[model samples]
Target: MAVFNPFLPSYQADPYPAYAALRAEDPVHFSAAIQAWVLTTHEDCERVLRDQETFSSSSDTASGQLATVLQQQRREFPLGEVPTVLNSDPPVHTRLRTLLNRAFTPRAIEGLRPHIEDIAASLLADAGRTGGRFDAVTGFAQPLPIIVIAELLGVPPEDRDQLKEWSTAIANTTNVLNTEDALAAARQATMELIAYMDEIVAQRRAAPGADIMTALVQAEEGGERLSHDELLAFSILLLLAGHETTTNLIGNGLLALTEHPEAAAGLRAEPDLLPSAVEEFLRYDSSVQGAVRFARETVEVRGRTIERGSTLLLLLGAANRDPAQFPEPDALDVARSPNRHLSFGRGVHFCLGAPLARLEGDVAFRALLDRFTELRVAEGGAERSGTLVLRGMGKLVLEV
Candidate 1:
């Protein structure tokens, strides 16, 4: 049996080869490192994500690897007490998503296109004056989504820096490995985040604004509205989900483009292909790499029986690169059509910010190509975020 330890620094640096090996030989293998079943194939991953009955999405205390990983911290984490979209199932999940969609409707998100364009253009213009080089993660990619989401949520300009600081801490909690220090930081961050959101929600109630936060706070349907706990949870979810993944999307997508100059040249020549190029970048190197699910009942997959209450880690990265699902999956093809990659995941829990992420990606690539004739990776390579569950560049310096 081949070992699948994604936590190792070497594997974190380049996980594709290991993912490829798993997809080929051990599509559904047990990873002693994570102490859970690792699902690599696209089909398996889709089944696990969609079949919420057999596999639960309950983030905490679901008898899965997550529950086991942070047995102590979760019990005290303030966010754990409230039911959010990420941790809820069925009626609860359906209700939270409904209230959320009221504020995050397609039209509502699309309305921010002009705003996204402005932010992207401004960031790139500022980077341009910096002697033809800038750290994409800090200067552009990281701030883009934070500013956009802060605007959407009606967070005041003066408060966004603090919000980003809290969000960064919250996002850091879910490291690939559930270490004591990480969990401790996560617990503290969760408590602080919930409290901060509570304050903002209170303010929104008193003085409503034309923002998602206000809409979410006041959203009502059939006499059903978000309770205090629900509002706080949803706020936390929006704050974290809105920026974190999109930041990675831009960073990873730009980095991938720099690596594959042919694709970059094609996009530069035919900018219309930027949309497809973003999809390929997602498939080739996704932002959120894997997800965890708890088994609701004894389930047999790939001739192996996983007992009920067991933890399962679905490797979305590996699944995206499965040769069976994607031909020449290793190669980066900007114009690959029928690109049904599971980057935003599948089923109900599919990313709500997906539309916004796509819009942002389109804006970002255009801004980069339009501003600079030539973009090259800096000599120091990348200081990748020290986590496999979330593949992102912490410092992606680029030279033009």
Candidate 2:
């Protein structure tokens, strides 16, 4: 049977039909093209994520387009050498995650709330002056996250544009480009970012400051701490993951509101509903579409037995819409109560930046709604990012 390529232009234009079809007929069907089983049900997705012992996160076992991308670039960006917390399992993942958690503590992120508000207000002010018409994605959504992430990483304000370009290149290199070139670009970007971070680390080492980087350099648990390379890798991961995902969240949320005016109006009437509205946005159009896992042992999920070493691709986007877990699964209801969406993921690998992301989303949407009295899609249908794993609009034009 022909396999479904969700990244294709046709699917990007309207993926719900395909998702519904998969859920009904092939929730756990194997694809020869991708050489992996695609899980589309909510229960199965939760099982794969919760039972990490049975399902590994090794990219080698990640089949489909994502696997092809990794396979092509594995040599330069060998999955093993990189110390990203997202790819590890068990004790190692626990340790790395614990160390990183200190940087994003409640107090730490809360401290930046004032700064975040300032950024949002300034961005909106600029947008208002531009005659109440702008590319929401470029003018507002993209810049807010990038600026906040740059500030958090101790990146000098002068070099933020360079950081943004490098980060965008790294994200883009994941799709279409040859693995070698993509890997080279990633490595080059990593090196440049690390060189810049090295200066911050060195300065912090000399004179401790209030930044997370400074705190991390001095942090130690039982005399065990991050090595130089580990620090560099973790820092880069924070910079990329922190902004990129939230940027999409804001863009996708704005686009969704514009497309569904009723839902947008409901939010405008009751600003208190912003939290649930954000959840609906995550469920309706998740930022990260799916995640990869390797079957550590033979496991039966949703009536299918997955063989040891076989790869499993859990479609979070599909799971969010599964009727078993959600009532009125296809509707965009701003007052969606009991909205337990998996946009930030689940289990031990749950997004450390969730709090910050939520805060940003809440502040951003409220600001956008208050500033613009009349908001509608201005130009072009939403263009999704080419990457298969990360689901988001590439651009969304809005007029107010």
Candidate 3:
């Protein structure tokens, strides 16, 4: 009877062992700690993701205690349960996603490569100037994505630090086991961020620019456009999704490389392996550990019946490492091909920022390897974030 306690420090530091145990003994089991049925198998998670009709993403569709808790939390949100791309299902999600997709065009993403490379080089240069040792989280990983996203969103450079603070506060509330204090801080941050974004949105509306923010503001399809509240929700979501996840990706990837010198050496020798290396990093330790979905109807899985409206915690990290789907799943192989990881999710709700994230990672890792000959973890190891939903290091000191 293995229990899932994600809040435990040990689990936060390393949850693969727990995921392995669950996948071996009970692939689909209910966990009282988070009050959700945890799905660990890659097949099970993939099925749920693909069958969005049966499993809804909206907090509104969520029933049982999960719905009750979400309702209470919504009351505190500045936008008040407005269905965004992340939480909504079907037609509403379809509409929102279509408009948002305008800003993330393939051309738009690829065009940012030069800018991303510049940002990475500048950050790494600053870190190098720090005389060989620096906190990678702050000096490199954290700021790289923040600056890139801020520029993408048309946010001014002076306001990025404040935005990062607000985004971090909001990210803390993503954890299922979040405390009252965290929720309170997140509420405050949300309110302030909305106010700040309202001004930017207004500016974009008045005068468009060559940026994603402008694209979002002007996005129209079949006589439908994002409402004011929807805009706010999207802007907030972009900041979180764009900044937080990639920050963790870079941090976690660097940590992994340092741990596996052979992999790092191989990557340096064959830089074309970068694309695959980034994918391997994503699979090895995903930035987003899990996602929540509610069963829209009674469903049978692994001889277990999940009642209608029951919440399911799809463990993406676990699924990535599931032995059945990935051969030698735990091994770090940068050149592994046909890698289909759930890090960007699947179906309608797949991460829209995937292109940008992948681009950023490619540039960041390349820049690091090109500039610094050696990258070693500092005296103390990574300080892992407490949030269970998102996995990342808050601080990772590095010696180059």
Candidate models: Cα lDDT each: 0.82, 0.78, 0.89
Candidate 1 C-alpha lDDT tens digits along 1-400? 5679976777878898888788778888988777788999999999999998888877454564555654544457675667777776888888878877888788887888888899888888777465767888898888888898888777778888888887877777677565677667766777777777778788889999888889988888878999988887777777787788888888888888788888889998898998998898889889888888888889999999998888888999999998888889989999999798998888888888788889888998898888767778889957787464778888988886
> What TM-score against the true fold does each predicted structure earn?
0.95, 0.93, 0.97
Best by lDDT: 3
- Find the number of clashing residue pairs for candidate 1: 0
TM-score, candidate number 3: 0.97
Ranking by lDDT: 3, 1, 2
| Best-performing candidate as measured by TM-score | 3
- Candidate 3 residue 300 Cα shift, in angstroms, is 0.3
Q: Model 3, clash count?
A: 0
For candidate 3, write residues 41-88 as lDDT tens digits. Answer: 999999999998899987776666556677777877898688889888
